[model samples]
Target chain A: MIKVRKLVKRFGLKTVLRGMDFSVESGEFVALIGPNGAGKTTFLRILASLARPSMGLVSVAGYQLPRQAADVRRRLGVVSHQPLLYVDLTAAENMTFYGRMYNLPNLNDRIDEVIELVGLTNRRNDLVRTYSRGMQQRLAIGRAVLHNPDVILFDEPYTGLDQDASAMLDEVLRTVAARGRTVVMTSHDLARTEDLATRFDVLSRGKIAASATHKDFGSGNLLSFYKGVLEEGRQN
Target chain B: MKKIIEDRSPLSLRERAEGEGKTPSGNYLRAIGAVAWKDLAAELRSKELLSAMLVFALLVIFIFNFALELDVKTRDSVTSGVLWVTFVFAGTLGLNRSMAIEKDRGCLDGLLLAPVDRSAIYFGKAISNLAFMLIVEIIVLPVYSLLYNTNLFQPGLLLIILLGSIGYTAVGTLLSAMSVQTRTRDVMLPILLFPIILPVVIAAIRASGAYLQNMPFDQILPWLNLLIVYDVIFIAVAFMVFDYVVEE
Candidate 1:
């Protein structure tokens, strides 16, 4: 559902993503984990069409990046650490606004369904600012998935969530993944990522340093695999 | 070309989303309306944007009233300049906050991620910014009249305010988007906006002064034409380049 080849993203003299090539099949949940300043967020931003690639080609759902961005955007749902929601608007109002932006049909019913999916049905009418951080993050999930996008990218989604909130977000993320949408999430929380992602790709020094599926890890844990990859990148 | 495409039996929104039917181009107007509606609704509930603008605007005029201490003829001569200054400053506040609301929580990215044309988002924002400026201007007018003890309700003056506001917000909306990304955003907007908007401000003040002084039609005609030309040119330029301004 997504492909990137030799993707190099540079800000002035500094290059963040250096010739990184990556891909994900439809319905695959890939977790791109990296330490800070590893170009993980930069890579995801390019994928989300929020930033242009300094070099390389990106195609999502068969439409190319930057050139075919509007078409690509129609299929993309992005959620960063920031909620990307108006705190003053109610959850339902926020949903309705995005629904109109996407020109959704049967928007009211879909809004209800998505609100229920994120467990915000009761608080749907409350202003987003009135909600707890968890509730707001949960509603952010609702906003991202509102239009039934084919590809959803989450960047450090669990940044500030407490334990209970993280658990709730895990449930929401699972429900979204179970719906057979392609998912690419970037984070440094190894334990949570190991629990949720079907495949793990380690990003270090602007490239995919290592990658393996959950089954391929066999009896080993992601922490050890992640450590080995960082050491490997350092040595090379 | 778009009118013909919009007339066809296009796919329903659901189908277009579910399949690879691309953007629902027919919803162009609808997208712009949705954004404007969203801005107005948020502003209505919060009142943060309007209240600040009104306070600053009223403050500007009151400060001018006290500082100038002009006689009736002097007041008549400076009225247009003072009014435009109040508007330019107040409009700056509105434009900055309007885009900041979008950027503060990453809502700008959310807007850009929509399936519609980027220009739709620009126009949507410009329309709402214009509305907010006009709302402040409307209130400022009467207050200026009350303070200055002068009649300020000429139809020609109102028209001049509308046209000047349209030009200001059109260019302001685009510049605010650019400046919002910088670290010194609050300082950046006026620096980028004021010089470019000189033509609009000058033409507006001249035309409005003519109206207030009851100058002859031939005398006001040139300033009026200048205002019209400036409005059309800037609005068109802003429309054509908004995609780049808002893009990363």
Candidate 2:
């Protein structure tokens, strides 16, 4: 569902993603783990068609990025640290607004369904500003999946959530993955990713240092595997 | 949790079945309307942007009243200029706040991620910004007229106001989008916008002044032409270059 080759992203004097190559197949839940400044967010932004790669061949859902960005966007949903919601608007309104952007049919019903999925159905009429951080993040998830997008990208969605909120988000992620949508998420939460991601890739120094399917760990954990990759990367 | 995501493949499948029949232009218009409507509805509920703009406009008018001391004779000459200046300044406040809201709230990124043409987002924002400015201008005109005892209800003057505002917002919207991404966003809009929109401002002042004075149509025609040209050119330029401005 996503493919990139020799991706190079530079912001003036700093190069973030240097010759990075990555891919994801349809329905794969990929937890893209990386150290700080490993360009995980940058890569995701490029996939989301929000940023143009300084140089690379990138495609999402078979549409070339930046060039066919509009088509690509139609199939992609993104949730980042920010909720990307109107604080003044209610949860239902936010969903309706995004649904209309996708030109979704039966928008009201879709909005209701997604709001319920995020467990915000009861609070659907409440203004986003009045909601808790967890509520807002859940609404963001609702907004992202409102269009039934073919792929969804999450960037550090658990940044400020409390334990309960994190558990709720875990359920939301599981629900989304179960729907057979290709999901790529970036997180520092290794324990959660270990359970959720079907595959994990450790990104370091603007490149994917190590990648393994969940089964490859063989009773081991992502923490040990990730540390090993980082140590190996440092040695090299 | 088994039914959390739903089995709406029927709707999506039907949409796909009929997708080929759907025109891109229709989708584009829908996207623009969606964005504009979202902003308008949010503003209506919160009233933050409009209230700030209205209060600021009235304050400026009050300041102008004391500063300019518009006695009857001088009123004709300066009323039009003062009104336009008020609108320009107030419009900048609204524009900066509008885009800044989008940027700060991450709404801009959400809009960009939509499947619509990037220009649709630009037009949507520009239209909403223009609407807010017009609402402020409309209210200000009546207050200014009642205070100064000047008839601001002239058709020609209204036309000039409309044209001038269209041009101002077309450029202002684009510039504000650029400015809000900068470190000095609040101050950056006027600096980036004023120089580019000077032609519209000058033409608006002149044409509005002439209309207020009931000058001959021929005398006001050139300024009107300038306003129209500036509006058409910048709107086109803004529409074309908006994608680049919003690009991350």
- Name the runs in model 2 displaced over 4 angstroms: B1-14, B17-20
Q: How much lDDT does candidate 2 score?
A: 0.88
Per-residue CA lDDT of candidate 2, range A137-188, in tens?
Answer: 9889888877777888999999999999999989888888888889999999
- Put down candidate 1 lDDT per residue, B79-145, tens digits, no spaces: 9999999999999999999999999888999899898888889889999999999999889999999
| Per-prediction TM-score to the true structure, in the order listed | 0.95, 0.97
Candidate 1's interface RMSD, please?
A: 8.9
Clash count (model 1, backbone only): 0
User: Per-candidate interface C-alpha RMSD?
Assistant: 8.9, 2.6
Model 1 chain B scores worst on lDDT over the 10 consecutive residues at B1-10
Chain A TM-score, prediction 2: 0.97
Scored by TM-score, the top model is: 2
DockQ of each model against the real complex?
0.45, 0.63
